[model samples]
Target: MATKNVLIVLSSHDLLGSTGRPTGWYLPEFAHPYYVLAPHVKLTIASPKGGHAPLDPGSVEAFKADPESVEFVQTKSALWENTEKLSTFLGRAKEFDAIFYPGGHGPMYDLATDPDSIALIREFWEAGKIVSTVCHGAAALTHATLSDGSYLVADTPVTGFANAEEDAIDFSQYMPFMLETELNKISGGKYEKAAEDWASHVVVAKEDRLLTGQNPGSARDLAVVILEKLNA
Candidate 1:
């Protein structure tokens, strides 16, 4: 079997919606998947602006004691230090077997509508490759229209950072748009959440080749599932 090549896209937008707070790719969302895929596949990280994908400070401080998150911050600087621009991979979706988006509030402001990002998702989906994300990363899927003019997640069960979770953090107002709400609209009301708030929730729309995780707690588990799908 050939090695699976995956592309990980991060957000370059660091502002938390005019609140003057900073935000970027959430650490656990990226780290968990990184470690899971490191030993088993070829991975590449990219961002909209192409260099120094920012890490949400809140995540770094929040997951400060998590061994995986901490170790990632301490040792994986090189992985995200210089990413290829998303535009660079525009028509090259077949070069990779899959594409994953690690969420942070930043994507709400940028990746959600980036033409190249949207185009790439359509390209990958059309190629029958896996397309995945966790939490607010679903922003990247909100506007992706397929060649047939269908929203990629339409009618597919999917999960993302829930509105209730946003309410818990008191961040809903600062978000450009509600992640869960938008996903529901795109999925034709097929969006769902874990039974309890913040618990792990992953929705694998196998027929559509799409996978999504509900929140930070769901990141690692989602990666495991992705590995299984790739290995199978």
Candidate 2:
């Protein structure tokens, strides 16, 4: 069988706090999936804003402490150093077998509302390609519309960065909106979550080719499920 081609979207935002601390894609979100999928498939990295993707400082620290993540992080090809801009990729969504959105607070700020990103997602969904996102990356689904002009997630059970997890991370106060609540309001579908910590993850729905991960912890698990679908 041919190798599956997957697109991993990262975050371009560089600022983290009111003090202007540096922040980018959460390290584990990218590192974990890249390790699990790259050995078996061809992976390409891109972002909504494209160009040099940013790395969240905290996630970087976490990666440094773990040898496997450190190894993945050092691999130049996997680092999202340069990427196709979302606008350019939007017109070529069919080239990929699946698209994975790796989460960071940055995605919440950009991916959620970008028209191009929304259309890209709808394009993949309509083509019956696998679509998955973890943590705040799930926010991107907010703007995806179905053929009936309704929200794509309107009836699909899904999950994202829960309010409790946000609170634990102390980022809830700074966020413009809560992902879990917003997804619930838009979907009207049951939204479930794991415990308060980020180590737990759950894939709440899978119908046809659509899949979603609850939080950063679910990143690899989500990728594994996507791999199963692509291989099948």
Q: Which structure among the candidates has the greatest TM-score?
A: 1
Per-model CA lDDT versus the true structure: 0.93, 0.79
Instruction: Give candidate 1's error at residue 96 in angstroms.
Output: 0.6
lDDT of 1: 0.93
lDDT of 1 by residue, 33-79 (tens): 89998999999999999989999999999999999999999999988
Give the Cα error of residue 167 in candidate 2, in Å. 0.2
Range of the 10 consecutive residues with the lowest summed lDDT in candidate 1? 202-211
Superposition TM-score, candidate 1 onto the true structure? 0.98
Regions more than 4 Å wrong, model 2:
204-206
lDDT of 1 at 181: 92
lDDT of 2: 0.79
